[model samples]
Target: MSILDLFKKKPKVNGIIKYLNLEGWWLNELSDEEREIILNIYSPMGSENSIIEGEICSSSQTQLHFFWGLIGWFNKPELRHIAYKLISKAETFIDKSSEPLDVHFFYSTKLEVFYKDRDLRPNGLELAIQSCEQQIANAPAAATAFKQKYDGNLPAHKGYAQLAIILEKQKRYDEAISLCEKAKSQGWAGDWDKRIERCDKRAKA
Candidate 1:
């Protein structure tokens, strides 16, 4: 390639860096200042430390989509894949080096994101169900913060609520109702009765 061509060409970055290189895709049209602000914000998020710290809960949502515009999932379908890749990279290190509570929170937040974008991705809902269910089955306690650290609103069985809500959305009303009932039996701190009642009304109607 000629010297001028080399200079004009964008740098080829791999892994997480490529995903943030909006210059080639989305940011070329944006002003230099606009691009700089976005890059400054997102570049840190893609770093190893920031990614590992991304734990999702109702009180403290995941960091991946702190910039809501970044997730424009339906408009920019590629963004979700970028998110999935980042999450996958973190998963490789979760069991290897992360605390059990951190791993638990990661899965919880992933479950929320997958289900939230169920319409965009073919396996979104399925993955969401599995994420919450896996946490509920294996490490139900880890998702909780009993010390009132980040709001102990739904300790020990938040996954149950998440999974049941997804099931409810899918119109599997009976399954949703049953799951809520189970949470009620376990003494979870959620409006389980309300959930069951809503599902029952929907199922009957």
Candidate 2:
């Protein structure tokens, strides 16, 4: 990446570097090519040649901001399978020794990826569910777990809300309602009443 950095790299490359540079990120477990692909998916440039020896590059914004990361990447149905592969591997490679909240956030990302990747949905949902539940139980607040001179960047995972939405989508409306209720009790910042109302209506329907 250092040599790649010597040249003007694309947004994808820059984004991957940012993700890897995140404290406790373990990008070494992945190959250079794989890292390029992971970042490239987040690039708004669609598909293009991967960074090559001495190739000049450019960057841009698209339908979504690059800050959206895998969230934006996962929505591309054509690239969805690739995202599943990369995210699953990233989940393994992520350093658990990082700040607990960061760890929780990455694991919460798995819930979003699995829920969105309909083909890979069934096998991984339970893992995401359990992980998120534990996260909210343990580190329910960002400041509580992060404990640094606060930047707006590192915040608590919306584990309760994310899990509730997944549960709602799965038509486990009762569980969804219960989860939203728990989020409200825990003081998660979201419209829980509305979510609970929607879930209750669905449950009855």
Question: Counting only residues 3 or more apart in sequence or on different chains, how many pairs clash (N, Cα, C under 3 Å) in candidate 2?
Answer: 0
Tens digits of per-residue lDDT, candidate 1, 145-177, equal 333456645464657878887788789999898
TM-score for predicted model 1 compared with the true structure: 0.53
Model 2, 1-205: lDDT tens per residue?
6876769643333333343343223244545665556656544465454322223344443211222345446646665666556555555543445445545555565556555544565756676676577567655444455545454444434678778878988999998888878767655567789989998988888
Give me candidate 2's TM-score against the actual structure. Answer: 0.51
User: Relative to the unseen true structure, what is the C-alpha lDDT of residue 154 in candidate 1, on a scale of 0 to 100?
Assistant: 46
Candidate 2's C-alpha runs over 4 A off are 1-75, 93-96, 119-138, 141-143, 146-157, 169-174, 197-205
- Pairs of residues clashing in candidate 1: none
TM-score of each: 0.53, 0.51
- Top model by TM-score, which number? 1
Q: Each prediction's Cα RMSD?
A: 9.1, 9.2
